[model samples]
Target: MSLFDTYIAVDWSGGNDRGAKPKRDAIWACAAGEEPVYLRNRQVAEDWLAARLEAEAGRRVCVGFDFPFGYPAGFAEHLTGREDALALWDWFEARIVDAPDVNNRFDIAGEINARVSGVGPFWFNGLKREVNHLPRKGLDRTNADFPEKRLVEMRAKGSFTCWQMAGAGSVGSQVMMGLPVLARLRRKYGAKVWPFEALDSAVAFVEIWPSLLAPSFPGGMIKDAAQVRAVARAMAVMDGQGSLELALAKGEGSGAEGWILGVGAEDLLEAAMKPIDMPRPPKLRDDCFALPAGVDWTPVDEALARLDAALRCVVGVEQVSHTQVVGRVVAEPVTARRSNPPAPNSAVDGYGFAHDATGEGDQVLPLLAGRAAAGGAYGGTVPHGSAIRVLTGAVLPDGVDTVVLEEDCSVTDTHVAFRGPVRPRANTRKAGEDVVAGSDVFAKGHMLRAQDAGLLAALGVDALPVFKRLRVGVLSTGDELVDPSQNAPPDRTYDANRPMLLQLAAAWNFEAVDLGHVRDDRAALKARLDEAVGQCDVILTSGGASAGDEDHVSALLREQGNLQAWRIALKPGRPLALALWQGVPVFGLPGNPVAAFVCALIFARPACLKLAGAAFAEPQGFMVPAAFEKRKKPGRREYLRARMGSDGVEVFASEGSGRISGLSWSDGMVELPDGAMDIARGDLVRYLPYGSFGL
Candidate 1:
């Protein structure tokens, strides 16, 4: 119905046709049009693909390829040396989502590639990468060999077709092996990728990202940082990730060892090529890109660099001990400073005296008259056959333990009639009963909450020193951006981001100072940005951040700010940009209200927390049931503003991030089905929970 008449994705692979091996090797393809069909096989794969393109010629057709579109710096040597290196990526990055980077450097490609080299039982499946132990309707199960060996054999035969390149174990393995790096690179350097041949049709049709007509960063392997970044900047245009925003301006690592092709990869790859010269850098070919598998990007290495850089900047915040400060981000772990009860004290308002030793009713005894009132202690011992008079909060006199209430005791001038003697230490609050001294009450990086404040107060803490919040600046830019005082233009509309942004910033506990909106003029925008630097810690700009001719933010930013990453291969919020200006971190939020909100949730909110010096600031979304049947293509993540409906949480059918109305109809955004999983009504879907999301 739309301009994209059909979207087809092909996953073509080699079939061992000598009858000795079954052409079970698969090459998948799909076309989204009047009718969408998925094709798998070398013979049928290309003809079907060419026919669809012809039928939909002149119309935008989207396709996905599972082959190694670009290999390492020198493919011939790299492929020859490594035994089907692509097979190693079967571990988790691409297929298994949420696989955390728990250890040293969790490089999905490198890790899996290494394992596949000499393995008995491999971890996962390739074809339908989602092919777990469970059987599906369309797939015919087969014992596919390790992707690395598959590629080595294919490359040896010199018979590598696009189909073989796409569906062979190498193609399936390497493409997927390279998936995380590609995803991150798409984030690192905005790149508009051309899919090879093996993607699903409906899902492949629309440029998939966080917005409409957005392209899923066609994945590719690049060797140079400059190239990776260059591609990222360019991709920003196609995907609307983040645009450079200099006019609205303001301010401002990980794993090791494999699939690394650019810059220093030669040293390692060279050693890999020439065994004796291990660890030395390689001299890679200029034309190709490196595969990320079998590579190690040590976390320790990056963390050291980060720490080295981090320690350079003297932390602006002051750390105060729990005993000295009332509210602070606990720098050092805090142990209970003192025992809650200095000594045994009274618990009740009733009398505090040594009653009869026997269980008797109202025993008349000589009241060893002594007042151990809370502040004024009697500091004396009591003898037998006598008692001491004490108030509720009084410390018990020596030799006279426990207390009898006035109701349980009778009064006399010097003698008192009381109930039988109570148990030892009864009616008394014990020492250290509440909190033991020297035990950890709070851990390092604990954010002071309300109850924590009260506890600190009770511990005799006054004004507690806390980490100073990072100063953040917000600037909105656009030709149509007018303040409340400005008169309306014939075609201009009021900026919808400022008020909501201000409110959202405040909600994150950021000391957000609104720089107001700057007109389309570059000088004005730059001036506003310069002024903001003196007053803010980070700068945020909306609107004029795009590459459009009228948009000045991009050009201004390119002067000093490298567009590190923009345009996500997802929907809504894809146009967001993350950049650095004058060493300060700047985020370019899309002008669309809904896009801005969702992007802010993903990027801005986290950045604010990081700058706020609050480790507690986190963006963790939840999974809830979808109240309605929502359909989507594979390859791109989708964010749909959804309300916590009566059933669970129904996503608004109208999920255009550009549409402000969708935001009003939902509680928060739902991250719809990721690649491979088709979301049906009533199925639980991943989403940013209402708590983490700021309206």
Candidate 2:
């Protein structure tokens, strides 16, 4: 029913095959993405592969074979004739994407003739095609002594590297070869390379067995294997695995070579890229639109428009309790009922009295009678040259203008000598001087920050009601996905989104509950959904949200709920599905871990907060440039993962949503919109702080 039934793998070597040697040199067999089927010996592996292809007549299959389709012809001339004879042999390996005629052999016999007979003499004339090859004995196509001599020479100096784009002098390898580049990549790109075994397996699944007789595309990277695995796991957040898978399936392209992205996107991208041990430098491509054709590039209004439209859906003016006011926007116009410090009591700890009330500086006015503490009033008015005692925060008598400190007045027989000349309003606080009781305190619809909270406390409010936190139910699917809490195999890792989602929900005022991860099977997912609908106001699931052959989320929704949106044109979170289940919004996030986290931040986080009665704000990416060149498809918006770059804007690198490093390293992500921007190096852009992920 699919394009290919089975895949084949062959690890090829120079000359005839490993059978020509003492041991097995080729890894030959069937492999979908794992162990190969090992059909026979190196040389024989090809024949067995040919037979397998023939056995499945008319059906197309993918086969993975290891060999440099072209090699240095001097290897053959070195075996049989003089050194100058190398001129008669032509090099035959090197390739460009889809440029088949450049070096591919016309047939097996022709390849043998070219190698053993030095058929393409012109290749050696140009120094560019020099290569190292080994031949086997008794093989009609090659001289028996050639391989041994070549190997000896290789041991002495030259080394043989597999013909992946890495060794092809491609942009990626070029960037990787430099020490500065390596440091930058690790510091910036992190690890995003895939292993030979993994790549071989993916190709094999496509039944490239016929390729056993041929060479593979040799598209592997020179990065730490462990990092590659980690990136793959991270990529699970978004359901996207690698460059090829996302390119072919979602048509979301990564056509650039280098890029600097905001931190958030970098984290999301890291989650999507396959993990490796150390960071590897990636070559950038230009399959996207550069900012305008010159300088003066500005953000397209449509992008802002899109952002605004989305925001409008959930943002609203709403009244909220002062207790619940922290971080919530005030929707109504608010005014302070009274000014701060409504009345002036005492500025110092000393008694209050009339001006010239001090003896030294202020007259020491004797304590006639203590004025009541705050709120109690003095009944009678005072005469000229008089003072009254007042404590801190106490109400002064009606007749008292001010009170002099006891040290300032010479008190004798109730006649306190007011030393200094009396200034009517000097020491006394006039009524309405501290504050007018009718001023506005705060406005409505404003986001309440910490200072705002303090203001409310000062206003005498102890407990308050805030907008209720949104309650979100979390779920995941796929039989391959497992609960990380329990033990798992070498291939298994714990589910990451549940905890991440919970944290994000908390940050955004959404109450998140873990509903557990499930399998791709419909019945199980449905059962989980049924449980979720009863307790949660919003339902969120990671994985099984795409349209893969085995994916079942859509089918389950059709059977049990109402699906509103299927596939989105959005990058990194393309497989996102939105629906209404039992009147509660359901966000079927992509199964890929990276996509899940990013999408949750994008849609689910805001939606949950809005449902919880909190004002909604959209999270956006900044428009920084490529720290390095980045590749992308022409049409869809690409989410590139990058670091907070030393430059302070963003430094773009690997972790392209296909890699986990993108999400992990990024403080935020840069939006590589479809037509206007390329995220090239040194561009000014909007910096979207990791917006509103509750936790």
Candidate 3:
């Protein structure tokens, strides 16, 4: 069954009321498989829609309106002191004062402009008489505090700016006037608005642009009427095909600025009207950390490839406040809510004037009485053949397209002189230049840094959805091991691997849980494993992982859990046991401290990050010249603890896996390939720095 049983489209009007007769610019609405119905004014249109919706009770319906349901990001908060589109709607609904033929839309526009600036971002007064701050022409207004177009407008080609009020292609007035009606209908019917709320309601409203589809009806019908009918039928057809739900899915920049229905699904709409077959998206499976069959002795590259294929983001998402998001992975794309700098402003301290006002050569122009500073804009427009003093970061006054730096100009009490041939629109930052509204700032799986938090703050984002941190439990198994705080006999050594592994997990931004140490007993290790599964998402065991008699970790996994014993061809680390205990992934590492650390860096770190909802990233390595020479065999790969010396990269004095002091002595690792290699002094070799592993 289709999600929606009915679809309706409305072509709204923002101009003064037309008489009680069928006309072109009056409000028009059409239901699927029905003729267009014309309403004389806003009041009649609202009444007709309410009646139609009331008659369609118990049926799922979607209403599409041509006017924008929202303004650009930051506009709602700027006007209403809250970052909510519905609040802005309420704000307008309380003060709009709409009647059949006479409304205070122009006065309201002027009032809104007065709050933002004495001059406007809102313009085009269609009335004959003047309004307080509203201008008649777009060029007469200074829009230095907000972007002229919304993010959706930039993406939807040929879309009109929501700033224009009553001139040709003006959508701004419609938004200001239409939102009040939408608010009333939503409150009365409990209908949800698309892109703002989840589409779970029986009656849902969507923002539509009728121009997206060409209308085909008998000749002589009003263009607006034809459009509403065409759009309404198209929506119903697409809904039946099941492609409409995909089109309504929330995307980048749709959070605050809203979205046009079928913006990216133009092809689907066209094909749906023709009744053609549509492709459905494939279903995704969460088979994270699942091992493939038939894996035995593995190469370094092959092991890494297998791990990459088996891993996916296994953590759930949460909306975290911007202040606490650092080091958290983004669950979705974080887009810019508002542009940085917001509007065009002077880049340097200068004399601002219109660039085309004069011809080439040295020129002089009268100075305006006041200056445009960073906090305040010049109240009046900058006339031709005149200039105004403007400081760095100041919003350029209307008609001022260019600025000549103070250092390049000669100033007097009433005038300023500068060399001619200045470039048009020079020394000025364009609106949305640094960061554009609706543009993606960070993609999914991105880890937030301190600077990222600052950028989000500047964009007015209070909170964002981020994946929860992965929980990693560290366990060590060895009969000869004891805690560092306890006295140990000569046969026993202090437990170094557990503490190191715990710290490493913490450094990698995972929630580190100390599962404590387990001795070489099958029943005791099993109890610890069961407990870890309840407390952690993943477990790490550092000893008794090989196929020896005392290898309880591998033996227990083989008997009670799913186990994959991988004998990797590598120095220091060879026997790697991977398993799933109670559906939680467990990594089994070697007993030697240095070998365990190497294996953790090479394999476990990236896999853990992937499970934590971070993108799988390979450890970055660069080539550095070797300071020492050595001959290697063709069978096993080797990594020597190393650091950059005065001449080149210097390897540790020994290649023994038990040399725990070598790890602390070195800053990175020097990797040797599997094939036989004869390395001499000054021969370049790949160097993997500790920092590259996120240490």
Candidate 4:
């Protein structure tokens, strides 16, 4: 059976403020099993939908609005350095203003176009001739950065680009004005946006192109309530046929480039909804966590400092051969086994002679009788009138204080002549110059690299003392989670957090132990903890830390061990729970994949390093201009997944923590600190690259 119990279709507008009556320019809404209604303004439309959604919180509902859910992927990246569709709404919300008689949709569109390229791609400005930025041309040269069509635009035949703001078949104005209303709806009710955030048990907002359904409605009912009613009925039919999901299935570039639900499902809608042979995944749970009352929230810096202070390195070191010690932390300082070279040598292919052998007027000297090579040196001192032939790296002959380059001298079998002045020891390497005897080559806590190992080998050190690798136990705790290898029942999901964490641990050079999954029951969690406490230096678990009925991880920790903190003043990763179980450190991460990944890198990486007898690693961030704007409250820090672009770093278009795709799409994160608000375009912000975290 389809999860959704109701379907709603809305015909959005892009013109000036909504009309007082049901007109072509006003917002129109119709729901399956209900009469079509005309809303006078955006606010009323929002209120009407909000009321219905509030009453049906327990039932699944899907609302489809006739507007572009997101811009073309390139425009989003160029303007905001983000591919998240919801972020583009934030960009519009800060700039566009909607009023009954007038709206700034055209102005906003022009502003965005100006930022995209010197010449705007959005053309055909409205009746107002004063909006000089938009050209009147039907087609014009476009910026390569901003493509004319979104992925859906190319896929759906006869579809119009969301860029057209004026003229016939233009939905651009509706997009600018409509997005803010949708943003409010999503924010007030925490509605999931399809293809970005996962479908919700309560409600989801999807993008629909009404024209795709218009042909199904008979003639004479082209552009009014009748058309909306017909479209709503079509939705009901599609839903009943079990083809709604096929339409809702993510299309190519659906997240950043919006897709029209049911755009290409002609024959599929004719079939009846049937159960698939494969096992179904679990229904999504709304178990978001926040800081508990009466508990003081810890700042990120302070929390890290406290964690490092409390963690002690795991004891025990192993002696490893120098060649095998690469990437291992040194347990003790390594001193030079012997002085480098053990004797003075030539720095270049040159001649060796006494510094004062040449007279003031006679710069040329007779070729020396003795010759010095790398392994064999001249035994006796050279005569004052002669010079010795010494190749590069050859030991200096006895009584030779200087060496001259072969290129600077004209040489024959009998004599050598100088073209320039030669300084004493100019091309000579003194004994112990590279490394003196007993000098420390590498200090304790230094992670040995290939070059360091090679240098140690050169010094004849065969074995080295290095700290033993720390063992990390990874666990996934949730009744709704199942192993991917197993056939999961409905209401269960394949575990993703455990495998991801295990892979990350391996990359960080830790001995990762898969502690496996635990049920939500307190006893099951306790048993898993007991099994892991003695086997690993650190334990990491995903889920079961929230204040939900099924959550047991936090409760078990509070009763059996120290439950230090429940949440940090951070976004996405706020629900982190830290504890100590039988003296083994435990990190309880949020169940959301993105949240789990971010928390692991931010909080877990440093803690693991400290436990492995390595120096605390502080990830450095670079400052870059924000391609998009954001308005947020002060106090808590927020991290938006982003990727580096040719211009600057762009954030992921969506902020849904449930969207695991964001982790792979993003190269790093953009940090908004406490008290940060209103990030205008081109504002400097701190960017943390994933590579900086040693990933």
What are the candidates' C-alpha RMSDs?
31.8, 31.4, 20.9, 27.9
lDDT of 4 by residue, 437-543 (tens): 67999999887878996687566454456777788999998889999999998899989999999999988888899999888788878988998976888889889
- Model 1 agreement with the true structure over 137-214: per-residue lDDT tens digits: 213223232222322223223322211222223343334333443343333323234322222232231111111111
Candidates in order, TM-scores: namely 0.48, 0.45, 0.59, 0.55
Model 4: residues with Cα > 4 Å off, grouped in runs: 1-295, 359-362, 375-381, 486-490
| Candidate 3 per-residue C-alpha lDDT over 1-695 given as tens digits, one digit per residue, 9 for 90 to 100 | 35676788999998768887888877999886567999888999899989988998987789999999888888889988987888888999999988886889999988888888547888888888999889888889876777777787787788998878887778888888899999999999999988888878889999988776553332468988988877777776666456788788734357667889877777876654332222321212334434556756688888888888787776766545454577799988988878886879999998999988966898899998999999898889988889999999999899898999999999999999988899988899998888988899999999998899778767755446678788899999989999999999999989999999999999998889999988888999999999887688888999888888999998899887767788898887997888888778889999899999999999899888888888777889989999999999998889899999999999999999999999999999999999999999999999999999998
How many clashes does each candidate structure show, in the order listed?
72, 146, 0, 13
Model 1: CA > 4 A from native: 1-315, 318-337, 351-427, 437-440, 485-487, 620-625, 661-665, 676-682, 686-689, 693-695
**Global Cα lDDT for candidate 2:** 0.44
Question: Which candidate comes out best when scored by lDDT?
Answer: 3
Error of 2 at 268 (Å): 54
Q: Name the weakest run of 10 consecutive residues (lDDT summed) in model 2.
A: 254-263
For lDDT, candidate 2 versus 4, the one ahead is 4
Off by over 4 Å in 2: 1-339, 346-452, 462-466, 490-493, 566-569, 619-634, 638-646, 672-674, 678-682, 691-695
* Residue 174 miss distance in model 1 (angstroms): 81
Ranking by lDDT: 3, 4, 1, 2
